[model samples]
Target: MIRTLDGKEEGFPSPLIQIRRQQSHLENWLENHKFPRIPCQSFVVISSPSTIIKAPKSLKSQILHSANIPYKLGVLEKKFKEQLLTKPTLKKLSKTLMEKHTEEDVDLFAKYNISKNDILTGVQCPGCGQFPAKRTQGFWRCSFCKHKAKDAHLRTLEEYKYLFGNKISNQQLRSFLHISSRTSATKFFSTLNYVHEGRTKDRVYFIP
Candidate 1:
């Protein structure tokens, strides 16, 4: 589950539903693989510090345990200890899994048919997770939450590297970051330890 800093769930699959789905998937995978039908437990842990999930009583009772942040961490530790495998068993399982494991590269963006044009572009507010924070006097200020962050553009650039690719041009950065000033975009690029190819207008920056 993903939430904004303001504590709102951004996407689908509520905690209870997600946990049920996980349980179902686990059972299916084990059966398909011809593995022993070992007992399994599923948990929906909301790690966002600001987010407090208030599930229905009926749903809560059905779930194994739904905890938040640090509390969830403790539960995880306890669960792991309870299901702890011996060193020999661990080694055997690892060896068995490794023999059947095969690495596959997946392009999720393409597979999901997500368009670059549909993606929101701007400096996002770190405090409230709002976008299009105005660049003001060496700091990015959010009009919504009144949060100001210095070097906020750095986070936006890092996101760009993930959503797009490692290589980006000055114009592309400006468009994606909603930056109008070429000098400002260049200044932002200079702070990063990146490699560049081509000269002047044709130059492209690569995150090394």
Candidate 2:
């Protein structure tokens, strides 16, 4: 399912050619894997119910709103129930697909013309929803709420790694996590068993 913020619609998501090309790519991949060819269906959902969607009749995808999903899903269940793969084959296929999968790195900050340095440091305090909570000695304390946490830095690191990059430097972690003291930052680094490479400032840490 797909949705657009503006109640605007083009022929097949973007243009006429891309849908067929993408479907062909999927079919080729399935053929290479010796799997059954599946039908490609498309759906575009829009928030504004008042706005009409002028979809092309040639396309296989449907354009609908959230209100129509339940009925559409009911109809789709029949197709899903028609095919049944053996338990072992299904498990093996799923495992193999997972093992061979590659992740695409996306840099949202750069795409949106935002600077990483401008981002607020430290974990957002859950109690007060305030940013860059002070990294006091042995605690992450929110100045406004007077709330303190020990493991708040962990959540901040997870966001940093997700939105920025999979790997982080000691300096990056310290700056982003709002740790002023190098000794404390090093101490925090010691707590994690992340895989490391390079020497001194050249070093990077990533989940093994």
Candidate 3:
């Protein structure tokens, strides 16, 4: 089951192709594990009822609208009853699949040679989705919509954490957030309740 957003149809993969690829991968994994090559099915459920799908007739059954899911699921349940594995067999397969897997972290910023200046920084407007919402009177106000938000900087900090790591100093926070005051940044970090190390200017906080 996959849920897709409205207005993002271009980003979505063809359900038929994704289903075939997934089924092929699953079959290969089952074969490698000396397990039965069980049949696999895929469903792409769009949340918007008005969203149109230009799928071929063969793929139409696999693409569902969110509103019709309950009835569709009820119909699919009757078909899959005979295909479910036994509880004991399922437990064995689960145990086998629980083996640890490790993947190396890839820094796309370094890999693509992206400079810090290339990234946009600032509290974004929740109202109009505009950047650099001005800090004024204990709130971040959007320049475009004049919308005010008290915790808009937190969202900006989240973006910073995703681009960089969770750890950030007061100076780094101010730089990334486009805040001028060091005292203001410290106060913001205090409100987050993150763990801190070192003292005074050397302090570094970790966002949880």
Candidate 4:
């Protein structure tokens, strides 16, 4: 149920080209994605009364405007109700889709003009807010407050993943966490439950 908020719909076709593109994308994705057998339909919805939208003769019946939506969807609901899957199958299918939904290789550093220099280095003590929380003997030692938190590094890693990509490699974890040792980076990743892949140097981890 998507409706364009723009008031000027003067010259556009009923189910606009934009609407058709969306429909095509959904149809193609449904037919080609991992679960290609999932059933779905696309509709163009507009609610304005004065908007002169004229679908080509072939597609007029497919467009849904305010006046005919209830009757059309009511009829559709009765037909689709019988096709609902069992709970277990539906849940497993949803879980698979969610696990595979992570977008790969999105470089936020380039997208929003961010760089290593822009991020504030050092972990602030979770106990007492203070910068330059150095990694000392496998613990984040905040010199200002003399507070040590074993999990402070995890907070920084979480933030880095949030701002960048959901997936991370040893190199990315090292560079983002500002750790020099590969063993130290491995220690950080050990605490997370990730779908691991590849051999030693080429391994990547992503939450599923």
Candidate 5:
């Protein structure tokens, strides 16, 4: 019989199976997408430790800084151990953690809902829609209005890299894109390849 971390039959085929299903879904979503923010948001909501642990080293640090959460490899390991109980059960523990994180993400999003129409005139590019177009090997262009603008979404990714590298959090990107929503930022970033890291948020820009 399948048992929960508490060692009780929770009545599902198997908690491990459930965790595997959830993880597979998450992995597929991330693989199909380019920008990290959306997946990061989902990861946060799910409280997936893998999201935190497997994140690019650059992004992880940024996430910690953006969330104002303390970071120590040992701390994460301890938390994972306490929640997971055993190495063999790490998958289930990670799923549980992701679920909790997802809850927190929903709460945070509700708290800070910004309308994109207010910032970009509600007019998206026709060719690329909200996402910019690839202009060159490291440059992106906005099809709408035919503006030769760099990727605006990459700015947040760079910020995460600068602050936490792979540890960057969705919260940080949301806050950075004050004029837009988290979803918008994620879509926008997916179009760009690089960004200019800066000290001030306003100065950040997607560099193709």
Candidate 6:
């Protein structure tokens, strides 16, 4: 006899034990009813809906019926034969399916207004100022007028700011500009004729 938490004698066979036994029996029945064979990689052509399949000689009608795979051996063979006959049609169908899938992908991208360039580059060159300088065989040219400067200028200015703490000396400016000679550097500096509120050596040039 089993006793419940409420202090009552349940029965010789408790409700919990009976339920477990029933569950086990049901599981065994289901396992026995399941099909023994796995499905093959064969695909049926949709062109002929009345096609059939033929099972192997080893699998009898009684066994097939027990497995619940509803098909006679003759019907299975007929279906396979029909599939072979419709090979050309299947190829055309496959090609059309691929084309339709590709078209759908393209349409989805277009709907989102996403650009290929955006995918490649994090930011698109806005073509602002002289950015994305026109490319020549050996150098990049300005997209604007014929105003051309050596590629070195862009890098030099940045270096000048770093070296001189932004209060660039005349000599330092020349070095930044990459002038070949000190004389040429001085000449360029004189052209600016910048005058600051200090002595000559301490004077800073300001762009006019």
Residue 206 CA displacement from its true place in model 5, Å: 24
After aligning candidate 5 to the native by TM-score, how far in Å is the CA of 161 from where it should be?
22
Lowest lDDT block of 10, candidate 2: 8-17
Q: lDDT tens digits, residues 45-147, model 1?
A: 5444555556678655343333444565676677666554567766766686688779565565898898777788999899999989988787889999999
Per residue, candidate 2 scores C-alpha lDDT tens digits across 1-208 of 2345689633334634565576678778767998766666556555667856666675434667778888878888876776656778778778878987898777878778988776777789978889868877778899889899988877778888778777888888777877777777777778887888888668888843
* Candidate 1 lDDT score relative to the true structure: 0.76
RMSD, one per candidate, in order: 7.9, 4.8, 5.8, 9.6, 20.1, 28.4
Candidate 2 pairs with clashing backbones: none
lDDT of 4 by residue, 1-208 (tens): 2335676324434455766787777667655654435446566666877656555777766766788888888977987776546788678777866876875676777888878679876566898887768777878887788899887876776776677656889988777666788998788778766788899989998844
TM-score of each: 0.52, 0.67, 0.67, 0.43, 0.20, 0.22
Give one digit per residue, the lDDT tens place, for model 3 in 1-208: 2336585433545666777787788788878988876766677788877777776798788888998888897987888778557888888888887762454577869989998779888888998999889888788898899899998877888888877888999999888877789998888777788999999879999977
Off by over 4 Å in 2: 1-21, 45-61, 65-71, 107-110, 197-204
Reference-based lDDT, residue 72, model 3: 90
Off by over 4 Å in 3: 1-15, 26-39, 44-56, 64-68, 82-114
Candidate 3 clash pair list: none
Off by over 4 Å in 1: 1-105
What is the Å distance of residue 177 in model 5 from its true position? 17
Overall lDDT per candidate, in order of appearance: 0.76, 0.74, 0.81, 0.72, 0.43, 0.44
Candidate 1 weakest lDDT stretch, 10 residues: 61-70
Write one digit per residue (lDDT tens) for candidate 6, span 122-174. Answer: 11122333433432432335555444443524343443443333465666665
Q: Count the backbone clashes (under 3 Å) in each candidate.
A: 0, 0, 0, 0, 33, 8
Candidate 5 structure quality by residue, lDDT tens digits, 1-208: 2235666555435333455577677766554543232222212222434333334565443233223333444555565553313455545546655764642123322346754333322223344567434343333456555555444444545433443344333344445434345555554445543354554434344433
TM-score of 6: 0.22
Superposition error at 38 for model 2 (Å): 3.8
Q: What is the lDDT of residue 173 in candidate 1?
A: 84
Worst 10 residues of 4 by lDDT: 7-16
